[model samples]
Target: MTIADSPARYGALSRFFHWAIAALLVWQFGGICSEAILGEDHPLAARLSANHTQVGTILFVLIVCRVVWAILNRGRRPDHGPGLLGYAARLGHFSLYALMLAVPTAALLRAWGNERAFAPFGFPIFAPRSPDQVVQTATAIGSNFHGEMAWIMGVLILGHVAMAILHQVAWRDGTLKRMT
Candidate 1:
């Protein structure tokens, strides 16, 4: 049975989105971090980097589903508690949604505009740029901001995790149970 969301907790779909995205993000950052620390040619880094585009495309799809599901269930999800924490929760979630869309969009735009063919899962999504000319604008945007915005997103995710901990430990609330 599909667990629909209730006033006190998230549904199966919401929890799936939450954990699935969280897992993919872990993969993305693992690749990024591994490349930075162990060099791009290292076996672990190479394997992860090789699948970056495919994983990213998957994440894009998941985010779209997540956004739609969230909107549909907006009224059914738990309320952000009153006062400062609530405001912080709202802002944090908004930032995550915005970044989730923005970061991958930048990469996808670059892939579409650049000379390289971007065929995630062996399906040609974006054809290569003209052989005679190179596109700099979109490539520049992706090169500049894809990693940068992701780091910011990473910070937000850390804050999110910390808040969950606070809710469970300090506040002694079942805030973390909403998704679990």
Candidate 2:
């Protein structure tokens, strides 16, 4: 397959980004769900959660790249449609992209404002924030909406998968093939 997208289908790069992000999202949510099930203090939960920051950091970087690539190939990609389904597809995708960025952004902001060093994979990205001065805004944003928005993103993703299945099964439109 080609590296750049074409009207008929997504190329190698797009597929890589799509599947990579999807796998990482599964890892991310799997960790959360596992923690909830096994108890946050369980050894299994701890093991999964230990890499959360690192994975999220990687995801943020990749999502940024994905956005840029998508824009570069926007004209060559498949169209959503002209009707309501198309509009919903457009909106759902936009929401997914937005949430993909927003969730990690909230975590990064929180880490930046944290009293401890912001380290992902043992590399310090942000030095410790001043003990005397707390970034209330950043903390509040992270605390208030991070998890909630993540769950909302989950719902959007389910819809996305459902649409893909619908296209592949019911509609037989080969929509799933665009990024396959």
Which one is best on lDDT? Answer: 1
| Candidate 2 lDDT by residue in tens digits, 1-180 | 799998888989999999999999999998898898999999988888888988998999999999999999999987898899999999999999999999988888887777878878888798887877668888888878888899999899998999899999999998898888
Best by TM-score: 2
lDDT of 2: 0.90
* Tens digit per residue, CA lDDT, model 1, 62-151: 999999999999998888888998888999999999999999999987887789999989999988878666678888898899989999
Off by over 4 Å in 2: none
Q: Report clashes for each candidate as comma-separated counts.
A: 0, 0
RMSD of each: 1.4, 1.0
Spell out the clash pairs found in candidate 1. none
TM-score of 1: 0.95
List the pairs of residues colliding in candidate 2. none
